[model samples]
Target: MSLLTVKNISLAFGGPLLLDGAELTIRDGERLCLLGRNGAGKTTLMRVLNGDLPPDGGDIMRRQGLRTALVTQDVPADLEGTVFPIIASGLGEQAALLEEFHQVSRSLQSSTDPALMERLAQLQKRIEETGGWQMQQLVEQVIRHLKLEGDAAFAHLSGGVKRRVMLGRALVSDPDLLLLDEPTNHLDLETIAWLEDFLVRRDKALMFVTHDRSFLRRVATRIVELDRGRLSSWQCDYDTYVQRREEQLEAEEKQAAEFDKKLVQEEKWIRQGIKARRTRNMGRVRALRQMREERRARRERSGTADLAVQQGERSGRRVIEAEHISYAWTGQPIIRDFSTTILRGDKIGIIGPNGSGKTTLLQLLLGRLKPDEGRVKLGTNLEIAYFDQHRGQLDEDRSVQDNIAEGNDWVEINGQRKHVIGYLRDFLFPPERARSPVRTLSGGERNRLLLAKLFTRPANLLVLDEPTNDLDLETLELLEGLLVDFPGTVLLVSHDRAFLDNVVTSTLVLEGEGRVGEYVGGYEDWQRQRAEQIEDEEKKPQAAAEKVQPQRPGRDRPRKLGFKEKRELEALPARIEELEAEQATIHEQMANPDFYRDHGDEVAQLQQRLEQIARELEQGYARWEELEALEG
Candidate 1:
């Protein structure tokens, strides 16, 4: 069933049209992921679909009584109140009565004054008279479903939790369609994973715009892209969509080339002499004029960001070394007995829950915060450029060009001088946009500005804290490529699984209780190794119990492993290595851009084989450990 349909929708600001005759049908039970460049009017289209913004032209047909809710990109600054009232606000007209009833009811729980009880009774009577009982129940249910405390102040919640509150507010109305813009912007890995699971399990229709590729892959049933003021739907997953979209762009370019060639020939013929302008050729002249108009109106795709990292003089082999570092906040251990050595050219990812001190760890390593009990040593000639997740490095009051050039007309990159506007253009900023105040820029543009600013200086050490936030997939992948090829060491703090998997060589996971575990490989690798470690730990208790227990009088000693089992145990290491080797080979094969185009069908098979190999290697390692424990 279709919940809403947009037909011939066109919207325009003062400049180019944002949505030019865009058409879409949002059906029930479909999760559509909206993809586009930063300023391609994705949010505007979302707003139009939600009926918050009226399109300049076209019709939107909604099923009778169909409800829709939207969570905007940024939380409204003036949104205030406890969680319950905020959620109840979704119930139009009866929200005040329900809020008063809730407040009076809670007051009576603590103080059973006659006045309080009377007020509560009166409020309840009003709520019942207005037939808001079901709506009240819905408000509570949404809070419970979202795991939010009904009485907690919305102002006190973390950004992620605040987003959840907003989501709950949207859901309280039991909307038929939910539209979210950049839903994963401030979410941590655990919260993102939980949200992915939650949305996948929900039956409602969802249309979300997100830069998180992993979240998009797991949640989207279909992919829709907004490009050059037009919407294109891809009925496939993100990876397949990438391949097909590339092929589409290539075909469009070829057709455009042929059209341009024909237009040139027509121009040459029309310019050639008096015979072409004769009475019989008047129709041809009119056709050429139409072709010129068509060519003038064509909107080409926006250019990709040109990103480069300037390299400084080589740093010492040892970039940073922390010895038995212990840090505490409010007398609680955040990083305890954590120690590691970072070398040049090493890319490390730091991951943890929202408040689990990922940034604290980064500060400790950078010698910004003194460890309470241990020492951190920094290497020599380590010129550092940091990408702050909060974007604190950027000046909001200054124009984008001024922020980068600092009132100068030119800036130096890698010892070469470039004009400020030209440099901003490399980041996809036009002259007008580059002159706009930083505060007026979108989140993606702000992030790009920060990158442009950071890359201006030569640095041998790059410390990025959640640098992928608000970046488009194209820009994010470009940054990934830059990091991968960077000659210096990188300390990246990101929750983006794909980015981490693509760029980092190792991971530092902040397990609870002040334990920081180091693991080789990326996010998926850590998951596999951690799962195996947990399995080994779970088996240790049973193995110990068997060893300590007294033997039965008639039972023979625990039977030794058979010849086949012993052979299997001994060969497990070699088998695990073989599987790992194959996994690496597959990864290498898939890394090339040409791989998707050349061997598209093999991608899924390769992914399945990787999973199979991981499982087998995990089982083999576990079995080997089990056998060794028994033998001991």
Candidate 2:
């Protein structure tokens, strides 16, 4: 059964119609992915479906009492208070009572005041009467599943966590149809994977807009595209959809060409003087008029972005070298004793969890932030262009053209001069939009604008931090191709798995506890190597145990421990305890804010000792078990 049906939806703004007779039917258990170019009305259609914005003309029929929930791309600025109450607010009418009850319960835990006790009892009775227990349970369940702290302030959370909280709020409603826009925008690789698993396991229908191709392939059961104010349904996987959509566009182009050829012939005949007009049939004349109207009404597809990188003169062979670099922030180590040599033309990808200091690492390499311990050396004649994840280089109050050309009418790229408007057109920006303020542009458009701004400058090195956030897939693939073919060195920091796999030649992964591991390939290659390393580590103890207690043929009795072995076994527990005690002391010291400020020189030495202790404890426990089994 269909949960919702949209018929002949027509929506228009001042300039053009955003949705012209768009039709859709969302069925149960359907996971649909909405795709389009940057400004092709994908988000507008989402708003229309959620009923937040009504279409100018449309009839929307819903299953009786059906519920729908929408998670917008940007978190609301007004969402304040603790996480529990914020999420419980999704329950509508029962939210206030639930929040009051929760507050009273928590207060009674610290104080035995009779007033608090009475309020709690009254709130519980009202909740029971209103059948709000299920809603409360649902709120708790969502908190646990999302791994959110109920008491944590929503405003204090990171962008990724805030997105998750928003998702939890939507999920708490238990809606039959869920709509998500750019769900994977700020999420890291680990969180993206978790969300993928969660959505795939979920039973409800989903309609979402995303630029992450990997997430689209994993979660979408069907693909739908909004192009030129029309909705197209592709009942296949993402790869198949790409192939079929190309073939479709080709066929449409061919058909349009034939129509134009015949229209031209008719126009030529009609333009002939009175001689032709005397023989012209009335029906053919009306048909020719209709053809002219049809041609005028046609909405041609927008052109793709024409992206190019301006390469600077080649730098020296070596690009950057870091020897045993260590950086700490408020006593917490971001990178410890990490060393790597980056040569020219090395496309290195930096990846880690959000707040794990990927940006800090980039700053360290680019000589922006000084390392506390070791040194970062730069090669000669290096020219660098950086694309910040926060889009800090863009002035929001400035017009798009002014931001690019800085009030100049013309700009130079690679020794060639072009008008600013003409250059912006290559990035799909019309003259009017180019004159608009940067704040008015959409996220994808802002990203494109940033690329346009960045590519204008000549650079021997490119550092992109989360450049794929709001780009359409076509633009993203185009960027991948550009990076792969660029002769300059590149350092990219991104959470996009597919982008990393396609562009980077190596990866710098920030494992926890200040460990940075360098791998030879992209995201998947790193995963394979890490898995193999773990498998090898797990087999080491077993292999040692087997080697120590080799069995002879026809031997029925187990070997007893020698005197030295007994002493070593008896001493193992004390040694393990001593190691653990030292480890705990080190951790306590590291947690103090003043530790790094006062004893910054000793940070690396202490970290190395802690690692050594961990290894010793592991070996001691393994040996003790082996001896105990032999004695038994």
Candidate 3:
């Protein structure tokens, strides 16, 4: 059933036109991933659906009594109070009912008034109707899952923590429709995986904006891509969506002479998708418009930026060597007895849950922090370029060009002097945008600018922390291409599964409690190996138990059975066959993609139950063998 319909939605912010007669129908149980380049107005469109921003011309119709919750990209500074109360407020009606119910109960306890009893009864009825307890329980679960500090003030929390809180609020609301902008932003790999499982299990309609390709593959049932003030819907996963889009574009190109208008439309959408990530707020729309000419000029002049990272003087074969490194802060050890060797041209990706000391390890390697025990040796002629998640090197007060130039008229690229504007263009920043304050640029644009700065300086080692954050799919691909092509050694910490798979040669996994291990291959391969390790560990105890168990006399043969047991065992083979057939059906269902996507939780339960059934079937066969021996 369709929960919300957006018809003829035309919105323009007096700058670039967005959502030109766009039409979207959101159905129940649909997990739609919204994708687009920066400045493509994806956020604006989401705001329209959220009723936070009304379209210039359109109609948003929702089913009667349909509830909706939105998690915005930026956490509002004005949202005061502690995290717990703020999140509890998202429960809406149920929150009020719960409070009223508690108040009425208190009143009845204090005085035996009949009126109090009546009020308490009414509140109780409403609470049960709204599932007030369930709503409260969900809120608590969300908080715990997101690792929120319940007592922390909203303003005092970090940006990432604040974003998590907002996400928790929206999820806990238990709305019919949930809209999230950059839902995966500021989340670690563990949290992202947890959220993927959470979304897969929930039947609620979800529309989330994310650049995480793996996330889209796991969670999205449909994709609504916003481009060139239009929306294109695809009922498929991320990979299929890209394949279909490419094939369509290829066919359009082949028939371009006859369908020039159609070709133009396709190209416009492609051009819109090339820009990368969205700005921090919609207010920057005018500034974005100023770059339109630059965008056009660049298209007319050349294709995408040639991001050739200039390698500095060659470092020794050993780029970095750590000897028995141990670090502790206030009696709590973050990294203990960790040792690693980084050779020249080696690309390593660091991954772990949030607060797993990935960043601290990077800092320690760079000599920013001294280890309590052991030493880190840097190779000769090593010049390291670090890209932090916070983009701390960027000066918000400085113009983009100034930030890049750093008071110089030009930058040296490959030992050649390049004009600041030309260099900025290489990072997808237009000449006009170069003059805009760094703070005014979108997160994606700022990240690009940061990359631009990093590449200008010659480096033998590159250290990137969450570099994929705020980057669009296209830019992410470009980054991966650059990393793959770069001669320098790379030590990267990113939650992007696809990006890590494409770029890194090895992975460093930081398991909490001071455990670290290295694995060959990317995130996916590492995860597979880890899962196998866990399975092996689980089987060890069972294997040991079976091996150490006492054996009865004549165990090699079968044990004797009484007459009643013999009759029961006679039916065991047929029962075992029935279970095997049932298991086959469940396996078939699990193998079906649609079944798993639609009923993830049920499928998981079925898998567990199937194992139990298999064991039971095996036991039945064993009993039947014993009974057959008695007949013999």
Candidate topping lDDT: 2
Task: Between candidates 1 and 3, name the one with more favorable lDDT.
Answer: 1
lDDT of each: 0.85, 0.86, 0.78
Model 3 Cα lDDT, one tens digit per residue, 1-632 = 99999988888867557777889999999999988876678888878887789889878998999888888767787899777767887887676675565455445444555555455556545655676645655665677778887668899988988999999888877789899888888888878877898889899999988888899888989999886677889988788888998898678556644444544544454456434324233444444454454444321212356576778988899988988888987788888888988899999999988887899988888778899999998888889898988999999999999988888888888889999998888777777778899988887887888888888888989999998887777778888988998888999999889889989999999887877888999998898778656545554565575675533234244334434555687788789889989876875664454553455346335635654775576567657765677678
Q: Alpha carbon lDDT of residue 22, candidate 3? A: 88
* Steric clash pairs (candidate 1): none
Instruction: Write down the lDDT that model 1 would get.
Output: 0.85
Candidate 2 positional error at 538, Å? 1.2
Of the candidates shown, which would achieve the greatest TM-score relative to the real structure?
Answer: 2
Candidate 1 at 323: error in angstroms?
0.7
RMSD of each: 15.8, 11.5, 14.5
Give the backbone clash total of model 1: 0
lDDT score for candidate 2 against the true structure: 0.86
Question: Per-residue alpha-carbon lDDT of model 2 for 1-632, expressed as tens digits?
Answer: 89999898989888788998899999999999999999889989988888899999979888998888999877888989999999998888789998997786566445656565555556656776787766776677567656689899999988768887898888777688999999887777877886787689789989999988889999999998998888989999999999999999999999999999999999998889998889988899999999999999889998888888888999999999999999999999999999999999999999998778999999999999999999999999999999987889999999999999999999898899999999999999999999999999999999999999999999999999999988988888899999999999999999888889999999999998899999998998899778666545544565576575533323334345655567788998998899989987875675454554565555556645754776576568769888889778
Error of 3 at 229 (Å): 0.9
Worst 10 residues of 1 by lDDT: 550-559
Q: Indicate the residue-level lDDT of 92 in model 3.
A: 75
